[model samples]
Target chain A: MIDLYPTRGGDEPRFIDRQDPVVYGTAEDGPIDAGTLAGFDRDGFLTIERLIEPEEVERYRAEMRRLGRDMRGDERVVTEKGSDEVRSIFEVHRVSEVFAELVRDPRVAGRARQILGSEVYVHQSRVNYKPGFRGRDFYWHSDFETWHAEDGMPRMRAVSISIALTENHATNGGLMIMPGSHRTFVSCPGETPPDHYKHSLKDQEIGVPDEDSLTALAGKHGIELFTGPAGSATMFDCNCMHGSNGNITPFPRSNVFIVFNSVENACAEPFAAPSRRPEFIASRDFTPVL
Target chain B: MIDLYPTRGGDEPRFIDRQDPVVYGTAEDGPIDAGTLAGFDRDGFLTIERLIEPEEVERYRAEMRRLGRDMRGDERVVTEKGSDEVRSIFEVHRVSEVFAELVRDPRVAGRARQILGSEVYVHQSRVNYKPGFRGRDFYWHSDFETWHAEDGMPRMRAVSISIALTENHATNGGLMIMPGSHRTFVSCPGETPPDHYKHSLKDQEIGVPDEDSLTALAGKHGIELFTGPAGSATMFDCNCMHGSNGNITPFPRSNVFIVFNSVENACAEPFAAPSRRPEFIASRDFTPVL
Candidate 1:
């Protein structure tokens, strides 16, 4: 059905029947079985235990290191406590070959197309670098809440594909998601904390969710931690209530993040009061990925 | 100036000023320097020594072997002299992660966008398997002739980026290109040679270039052979007249090929007498690369 209150372009709300087993297993090439699709629809996200091969993992890891350090004037790399270590690298695809390949990968983006059902574009590409002891906790919130309020995203016709560049686990503080919480939007006092790495967060961006609401949601639907082998991938809906804990463990958890938005449902003009976030944080170009 | 007769969409002719040093060095991300752009504009192509990293090369080679052997009824792989060995793999990006990654690699496809002056799409992709002695010579002809006369490409705004999985050399039938031949379109007696593997060559296609014309052109412009180390990449214009000789050396030359066409100047309706080549051969989807 068409979205009556779309904040962005001419895209209507695109929701898959959380009960559809048929959509998950069906792809033009590669093996994404029917059971997988069913699980993804029922939950807010689906995890492919091993989406990347060993060679690719090795290559990606090496490239990520160089991107976080060697790539000069690479403004996207957010640091931890003003130190040299990287917290996250937003839009690494723009600077490196390896991450660029990941964003448009058929195994990753093809599944996105299966769910979104149209040509999809990369609204954002990021690398969450949860280095050992350096990684901090991310506040609980739905991504769409911030995107709609700050970036002018119309609806939730977007999926975030995260591939593990390093082993993601509980100790390392991998992403923790609230299953099936994407059905409704939660309104809260969203603000950009001053501690944010430059242009990383914006005003009206719901970083810290209300404790009462988060507690109620957690009581109803338990959280699921994204923990897996290197190269494992997960596709989550944009509105999925999610966050990650602090990584104090020696094992660093770094993952490549690619946000695929349906071409018809691209972001609109600036809705935030001050100004829109930079193109790197929230892309303006809506060219669809094949 | 606009294309007087655009094929399908309302796309006009888009040209890159060969004299403009600014176009190459100013990508949002990645190193597409002025020297590279100048080379591409001057010689009708540019070859990057090591675009694919060693790990990616290893991964792609491994995947290509399995795909050539195990992937059954997947008809894209072109075979040797009726042997099990794969001569070429077409539309590989649709099937595997490694190849998919290669097709969209920013270092490669990003350069394509630089020349095409718009979002680029894969018009066709194939790996040319020039084995030690089994490989055949691809006769001299321009790709644009086949694409324009047969595939109905509206203009010469496409570039093919070929990455060498194995070291390509003069002895191993490395690509022979006529520099600056892209300036003119030659109408030749193009036919589908029977010796060509199934799904490799098509009817009403230009394969053999006129000898007199070829000799005259070669005499005037001279030829350049693309011989480089493994992981090397070359981006050549569609209208560049190119072909290769049979490999007599022991070193096998197998390279992954990706043809990127500007979305605006994509292929129109097939002009061939028979049925149009399938999507696997000539993809109709014009979704741009991210």
Candidate 2:
């Protein structure tokens, strides 16, 4: 098959136009309204305040804390490179019922199905925990590049929903996405080493776009920080250029992140990597969410 | 379109021999061993001691307590008849991450897929809470009957797994199943009333087998109580005649119960009811567990 969004091979990054549509379904066909759908299509992302209730947010925060503490030795629990603090707990929906319910919630999964125009399944799920002082940053990159190269995801028919479990303020590290950057797929260059995810989960160094490319994308599209109260959420396209800064604030930051993939675009063999990432990191289970 | 396992709208209870194979997959193709598979085929159920670790059991117990305390007034929380005590929480896998992880656990979902010989989805899941003294009895009946009549489950291609979160002693009202009773599908007579699950969940009065039929089945197969320590699990066929008495013991009995149905046997229109039961009670989501 042709590698439309190729990555992890070569010396310089390659930019390619996105071949997929941003919004696959119309408001007439799903729970989202036309105006909101249009806005999402234009910017490649959308933020909703209070997408979940306060009680639900508290429950997820509790679950996040529990998993962070209990899953210390588990491989799926990725820790910060420098500190032992947990950076993310992968496959959280499969492990946590609170996040699992959120993955199936209408505001999240319904919108995903609508955006992809098909039944959706979880490709990946995690509780990103940015602890108070020593929290680390996740470098800027397109999720689709890694999913395609390392996880064997066939296309950009996926959407990610990150729901805030704690209040996200300017000081606390929150997600920053380049509006309209999803229109272009930045194919980072480098051969993915064996077991790349083991290191990448903690500190990604491979397949990161060059500084020039990052600067160009940010300059052209502009960066937007997703800041909102607990229970707020942001849904972004798979190829959106996004990352977060390290949190040094007194207050912690946490979110339940879920990636919903279209069943029609199920994964295949990796396009660039030596092997596919683990199921907990990038699920091979393509059973569509109903 | 014929009603093979017909119930309700009939005058007398009808007993039909199970038409499907009990063990669908060979041990060589699945995680279960040949000896265990043979035993399950013969007795229609198998119990594995310490199916989960003690720590995991305690975690689930904690989750159970939390759900029971906080889920009041939620429709999915079924209170005991004539009391405000929470009897059961339906679609528990969808509501609580702890139970959801238990549902996806290899010993649970993997064994289910092997027994059904197909990718399986959660047909129903609930945390059965039988508190001391006020805990009500769940009358003897084949789960397949209610599923076939009200939920439109087509065949006996489903299995139920109950994992004890607390020590299950005789006094605490553990499950009791009629050995080899699954071979006979006792088609109970009576038209299924609309919204039957509302009453049936707390205290079942509908789709129950006649006493004579139950007596004959018990007389032939004999009854066995599943008494075990916390973390032990029992997997039983859907058509097995089973029930549990009220717990009068101070040590309350609770178990995480999940039903896995083959993806091939997804629900159709109600075979004998006015409308299908709600999604939480009888899930319409047919996404197979991977």
Candidate 3:
């Protein structure tokens, strides 16, 4: 079998052309029509102004607060390094019913199924709680690189949806994805140590794309900062080069992040890592949404 | 590899002793404890008094009403034979967010995971709406028989959870399962037609255990009728000889039914049928619940 989009192997990180098609589904398969499907295929990402209503968004925001407050002791709750601030709550949907309902929402899961051209499962879900001043910056990286090397994802057949719980302003650690950057798969240089997710979830160091590769990508495809009101959402390809700055502003930036992987593309064994990460970080469940 | 639980090809119906373990998980795997797990293994099914709270039950009751009213035109809504009254709403979770949340609830999904020893997906889901006076009886048969013959489910590695939206009384067509009958695999005699589900969902005539086989099983293992208050639930093995009677009483019996199949035990090509059923009745999607 041919292994497309190989990563986390070489001494120097290299960029390879993506082998898989960007959009997998047709107009008749799901909610996405031909035009929108074509746009997503070209851009590698699509943003919506209001994927959820105000009342619904408020519910998720409330759940995020409760998860941050009540689940601090849970191992799935990753805290910011050197502080008590909750950095992220992995598998948020499992812990909170409000967030669980959001995952089942047709507006969310339906779109993922439409884009993936098949039934999809939640590969990972987290509430990225970036407090006003304490939130640290997430460096530039391709999610597929980490997923492939550490979690044993066989291909770039996953897509991530980030639903903003708070207003994502340009200055307050909003996501910044390079346009057309998803076409290239950047093989990161690293060895994924066993149980690396324990430290990496708090602060990722390994499996990061090298500076030269990042610079070249940034130069080729200009960075696009996602700024929108609460309830706004963005769906991006798994291999897209993306990251966000630290929130120095008073407005806290928080988003409900969910990754959807095709049922056909279930993880096998870790391609480069010594072992697989915990299910809360990189899920092994392959049940499709009903 | 040995086909442990084989079915749907013999001229005469016969029972084979179960080769798979009844309870696949230990206490560490999920919510079901040692004693409870053992109890489920002894009997083919287990009943919970308050699987969900009264309020949660009401929400499902409301959703059932909404689905019956609104989704009557949808192809997934199966009607009672010789009547316009809605019989069952197949793929109810996909059509309603409220029912969708119920499927994701750990109380529901966790128990399935606990019993199956692995991540599970919704093999099939429906809101069985047996209306008063007009409802018809479901013939005695094991779900795995039809699933194997028509849907290509290879083993009894699946379980069905029925949560009462309305109070389930003994006279109101409550589910009746033969205790210890799950240990026997009745090889159903018949060829499932190409579009068997179109008729079977409304009224199944094929892939049913013959009267002689059913009589022998009923004589050996005694029938137990499930009667419980609203919010009460039952989890039963896929191969259990079970069926419900017609509701002649004024009280209507409605329950949210969901089937959880182990991701590893996904369906393949049909074992006996001309073709596989549609996704609504026999789901091809094997994405596990988060």
Model 3 segments more than 4 A misplaced: B1-290
- The order of the candidates by lDDT, greatest first, is 2, 3, 1
What digit string (tens of lDDT, one per residue) describes model 2 on residues B122-169?
A: 999998888753465677889999999999998889999998888886
lDDT of 2 at A258: 91
lDDT per residue for candidate 2 within A1-290, as digits (tens), equals: 88778787778887999998998888977778899999999999988887988887778778888988888899898878877878888998888877777788887889999999999899999988888545666778889989899888878899999888888865456787889999999988879999998998887888777777876886688667677899999999999998765553334788888999999888898999888888998898988776
Q: Which model is ahead, 1 or 3, in terms of lDDT?
A: 3
Q: Which of candidates 1 and 3 reaches a greater TM-score?
A: 3
Separate DockQ for every predicted complex: 0.01, 0.01, 0.00
- Which window of ten consecutive residues has the lowest lDDT sum in model 1 chain A? A13-22
Q: Report how far off residue B30 is in candidate 3 (Å).
A: 77
Q: Which one wins on lDDT?
A: 2
lDDT of 1 by residue, B158-202 (tens): 888888989875445678787887665555553433333243352
- Candidate 1 chain B weakest ten by summed lDDT: B13-22
Fnat per model, in the order shown: 0.00, 0.00, 0.00
